[model samples]
Target: MSELVAAEDVLLFVNAAVTATGQREFRSSAEEQRFSLGFLHEYVRVNYRPVYAAALALDVNHHNAALIVEGLLRTAGEAGGAEEKRAEGRLIAARLAMLPPQRVYRLFRALRAAGVNNRRTRAIVRGWLAARPDPALDAVKYRTGVKAAVRHVHGRPADPETGDFLFAPGRRVRYGNALLDAYRRAHYEQSAVYELPFTVAEGFAAKHGVPRAVFLERIAPRMTRLERLRTERASGAGAELAVMPLTRLALYVLALPFGERVGRRAELTGALRASARRAAGPYAGSWGRVTAVLDDSFSSSGSAVKRRRPLAVALGCHFLLEALAAPGAYTALWTSGGDDPLMVRPYGPTPLGTRILDALETEPERLVIVSDGWDNAPPGLAGEVLRVWRSRLDPGRGTSVVHLNPVYDADGFDVRRLAASVPTAGMRDAEDLAALVEIAQFAEGRTGFTELRAYLDRRVEHFLTEAGA
Candidate 1:
C-alpha cells in the first residue's frame, strides 16, 4: 500500500512476463540476457537498478549519470522454471558484459570456472562493463574474492593451490554459507529478534518455563544496551569502541546450517507450540485472581500453609555476552547457536520460567523468590508472581520492591499523593566529604545496620517458631 512498493508492483509483474518471454526465445545467450535486462529496466525502472549498481559504480564514480543494469540470475545448477532460469542466467551475463574487457574477462572466467558460463551470461557481463567509463578491476576483484572465500567461486578468480574448482561442489551451499558468515559478521541477528520478539519469547518460555510477558518485563532493563552503534556514531560517539548489536549474535547463531548441527528443531518446536496453547484463551492472564481466590477459600489462618509461590522469570538480551561473563552461574538448559536444527520458536520465552514457578508454588517453604527486575528470566513469570501475590496474600503480607529509576512512576500515578512530604532547604550549605562522613556516622549511631540486623533476627525467630521449625 505504500507508494514505493505500489509504484513498483506492476513493474515486477511486467518484468516477470518479459523474463518468461526472453527465456522461450533461442537467441544467443548474450542477446537473451540483454533483452531480459531491457525488460527489467522497463519493469523496475532504470532508477532501481542503479541503487545496487551505484554501490558497485561509486569508485567508478559518476553519481546519477552511471547507466547500470542489475537483476537476479540462477547459478549453474539450481532448480527453477527452465525458461525463467535461462533468462536469469542471461541477466547475470548482461550485467557482466557492461564492464570493460579486462573486468569482463575476469568475471567471465570466474563464472565459467564456477560452471555458470552460458553465452548469454558472458555477454551480460560484457555489456555492463561497456556502459561504465572506468574499469573497476579492484571492485570486481574484491567482489570475486568474497565469492571465492565462500567457496562460491562461481565467479571468483582461481586460487594457486590444487587447481581444483572451489565452489563447484554446491552453489547453494557455497553462497549460503558465505552469506551466513558475512551476515553474521555484520550482526544481523538483532534485526531478526526485533522482527520476531514473540517467537524468541516463546523459545525462552519453553526452555526456561517462564511466561512471555514476565520475560519481556525482566529483559526491559537491558533494552537500552540494544542502542545501535550506528546511531551512536551518527550522534558523534566516534568510530572507535563502537558497540555492535547483540541481535546480530543471536541471528548468526540461529542461521547456522542446522542439517549438520542440532537436528532437534522438531521437538523444540512442539514444546513451543504446547506452551503457546496453555497461555491462550480468556483465562490466559487470570492466573492472578485464580491464585488469590484459591488462597482465600482454602485457608482462614492467613499464615504458613502449603501453597504454590508465583513464578518469577527474567530473560536477558542476546545471551552471548551474558553467557560469557558468567557461564557456570547460568543453567543454559538449551542452546541453538551452532549447526543445530533451527527451532521454530527459537526467539521465544525461556520455558523454564514457568517450570520454575510451578516448582516454587508446589513447595513454597523450600524456596525464596528474589530477583532484580533488570535480570533476565524466562518470559511472563515475573508478572505471574506479582499477580498472585497482589490477589491472594494476606493484607499484612509485605514485600520490599526496588525501582531503578523514578521515571517508572511517571505515567499519571500521582506519586506525591502516596509519598510522605520532605522539605527542601531554602539555602544550601556546601558540605565536603568530611562533613558527609560525620553526618553518616551520626545517622548510623541512631539507626543503622546493627539495629536492623537485631530486628531481622527477632522477626526470623518468631516466624520460624510459628511454623514449628
Candidate 2:
C-alpha cells in the first residue's frame, strides 16, 4: 500500500476504536478479536507517541487507553537514546495526568509491568494522584478493591453527585467543561436533545444555535467521523461543508437526508463520479467489468447509537467499486426499487436473492453485494441463484460473488453467506473498501489468518517508515 493509503487506514482504525462509546460493544468474535489485536499491536508498536496521544485525546475506554500507555512506556524503557527515553516518559506522564482518576488507577499495574520504576516516572504518577484524589473512587477501592473501582468506572452508572466532578480539580476538568457546555448549548439553546432511535447530532444544531459550518469546524473535530458525517447530514448542512476526499465524500453524500437532497442530486452525483475518476487513476487498467448489488433496506438504517447507518456505508462502497472498475464496466443494482439505481434511496425490505439473479443477466465478471444480510424476502433465493448462475450462466464459474456486511451479527457470525461457494466479508468502514478485492479472497478460502497477519505487519512497517521512527 502507498504511504497515504496506509496512513488513512491507520487513522480510520484509531478513529473507530477510540471514539467508540460505552453504549457500543466492541465485537469479540475470533475474526474481530484477531483484527483488533493485530491492529492495536501494530499501531502501538509502530507509532507509540501519537497512538498514546490519541488514546488520551479521544478519551477511549480506560483499559484500552491503559494498554496503549503501557506499550509506549515499555518502548520508551527499551530505547537506547537518553533524550528520546526522557521525552517519551514526559509525554506519557503529561497524558496520564489528564486522564480520570479511575483510568489512572487502571494503569497502575500496567505501568509497573512496563518497568516504570524510574524516579521521574514514579514522581509523575504520584504527583498526578495527589493532585486529583477521588475520595469516592478511593472508598470504592478500599471497600471492594482496585478491580471493583475499575469496574465501577467502566460501568459509569448514574451518580447524581458525580456531575460535580465535571468541575472538580483534575486534568479532565477542561474536557469535562467543554462537554458540559456543548450539552447545555444543545439542550437549552436548541431544544434538540431528544430520545430518538435514528437521530443524528446535526438534529440538534438548530436548537443549539450553532451553524453547521461552525459545528464542523469547532466541535466536529472532537467527534468520530461517523458522528460528524451523520450530524452534518442531519443538520441539512452537508452541501455547505467543504468537499471531502473521495471515500469520505461518498459517505457524506450517501448519508444526506432525502429531503435535503432534492435538487442537489445531480451535483452530488457529479461529485461522486469525479471522486471515482480520481480514485481510479492509480490503477488505471487493473480492473475488469464489475457489477455491485447494494442493499439499502430499512435495517441498513439501524444503529446502536442514534448516528449514521449502514446505508451510508453501502452507498460509499457502491461508488468506490464503480470508480475502481474498468471504464463502462461497472453496474450498480440497487435492491431498493428505482428507475435509476444511483438515485435509489435506502428504504423498504431487503431482496438479496432476487437482486443477484437480476445482476446475473448482465454476466459481469465480478459481483459485489453490500448489505446487512437480514434478507426478509420470501425464501432465501441467493443460494439457489448462485447455484443456477454457476451451473448455467458460466461453465468456468469464474464470476466472483462477494457479500460485504457492515454490521457484526453478534449471533456468532461476521458474514452471512448465500452459498457456501460464494465469499462473504465484513465492510467495517470506507477505508476497508480499498481492500475489497483482497477481502473477497478471504471469502473464497484463498487467504487465511497467516496472510492477515502478514498484511498487518506490512502496514505497520510502512507506517513506521513513513513516520521516520
Candidate 3:
C-alpha cells in the first residue's frame, strides 16, 4: 500500500516537475532532486517505464536518465515473446518521442552503449535525427504519431489530412484553414466525445446555442453526478434537473444549488439511507460498534467551481460505514449542526475535537473520521483529545482511529497535526470507501511495499489481458 502511495506520489511529482511553472513553491529543488534520485533508484531497479520517462524529462541528471535507458534495454532483452518485444519497443518509442533533442541524443547514446540494436530502436533514432529542430513541427508530428497509435489500438478511423485519429475531443487540426472548419463542425454536430474538458464543452455549447436541456442530456451523462450538479449550478440551469440521473442521489443532493435543496432534502436523506442499507447488507453479522465523524466545514465544500466534492466523498464514506455497522452499533456525527437527515452541507468551521469527543461517548471500537485534514475550531485539539481518551478510558481495548483525507495537501503531508498512532489514508474517489479494511491496514503500517507491488503487477496483467495483447 505504501509502495502504491509512493508510486502515486512519484507520478504527481513527475507531473509537477515536467510542467512546473517556476513561481510555485510546493517543494524546493533540493528536496525534489533528493527524492527523485531515491525514487529513480527504486523504480529503475524494477524497470518502471513511467520513471524512465520522468527521469529523461527531468534532464538535470544525465547519468540518471542513462541509467533509466539501460534499465529499459535490460527489460526489453528479458522479454520473451514477439508481442512483448513489440510492446516494449512501443513504450520506449513513446517515451523517447516526448523528450527534447538533447535528451533523445542522450538516450540514443545509452542505447548504443547497451548494444540495443533492434530494428524498431534504430527506426526511432533515425526518425529523431531526420526531424527538423522546429519545436512546433516536432510537437505536431509527435501528437500525430500518438494519435495514429491510439487509432490502431482502438480500431478507430484515421483523419484524412493528417492520417491520425482524433483521440481527444478538443484536439485542433493543423492543416490549412482546417482548424476553424473542424471547430465549427464540432460545435454544431457535437461529434466530439463528451469527455472533453468543461471549458471546451461550455464554449462549444455557447457557440452552437445549445439549450440547457440539450447540453445536460448530451454531456451530463458523461460527467459524475457531482460534476453535472456543479455545471448546472454554475450555468443557472436548474430547470435541467428533470433530465439529471438520480443514481448517486446522496452526492447529487450535496452538490445541488442552495435554492433547489429545500424540496429534495427529504428525498435525499431517504436515498442515502437506502444506499447505506444496500452497501451494509453483506456484512450484517460482522459489524461492531462504529462511530464516524464527517467534516462538513467550509473547506470540504472545495472551491466555488468544484463545490461539495469533499462533502460528497465524506457522505459516501458515512453511508458505507452506516450500512456496515449493526443497527444499534453505529453513530454518525457531522462537524456542523444536523439532526435526523444528515445533509453533508459545508458551511461553518471545523470542530473536529468536539465531534470526536461526542462520538467517543458511544464507546465505539472503531472510529473513522473523514475530512480534508484542515481542522480549525479549537485548533489542534483533536489529537490531544484522542490521546487523553485512549490513555484515560480504554488503553487496553485497542480502539482504531482512521483519518481519511479527500484533499491532497500541497505541503506533502497527509494530515496537519494528528496523533502519530492514528493512520491517515487518502480518499481520491468515493469508491475508495469500499476498501476501508485495506486503507486501515495502510494507515497502521501493516500493508507494505511488497503488497503494493503485487497489487500493481496484478493490475498490469489485467490491463494486458483486457487489451488482448
Per-residue alpha-carbon lDDT of model 1 for 20-103, expressed as tens digits?
A: 212121112434434543554344333333122212211211111122222332233332457644444433343343344444
Model 1 TM-score is 0.18
Worst 10 residues of 2 by lDDT: 191-200
Flag clash pairs in model 3: none
Q: How well does each candidate superpose onto the true structure, as a TM-score?
A: 0.18, 0.54, 0.56
Give the alpha carbon lDDT tens digit for every residue of 1-469 in model 2.
3443444344334433432222332233444544554455456457544433333333233444566666665555455477656645555565666555556765665555544655555555555544445533443223223333323233222332333332232423222333333443444554323311122345676555666566555454345445555576545444422245554665566556675466677777777666656555676435688888888777665454523446666766776777778878988888885545345565788888888888877777888888766666855777777767767767586787777766554333234456656766555554355555563564454454455445555644454444343
lDDT of each: 0.28, 0.55, 0.56
Better of 1 and 2 by TM-score: 2
Candidate order by lDDT, decreasing, is 3, 2, 1
lDDT of 2: 0.55
- Best lDDT among the predictions, by candidate number: 3
Model 2: residues >4 Å from true position, as ranges?
A: 1-242, 245-259, 277-281, 304-308, 341-343, 388-395, 446-453
- Count of clashes, each model: 76, 3, 0
Best by TM-score: 3
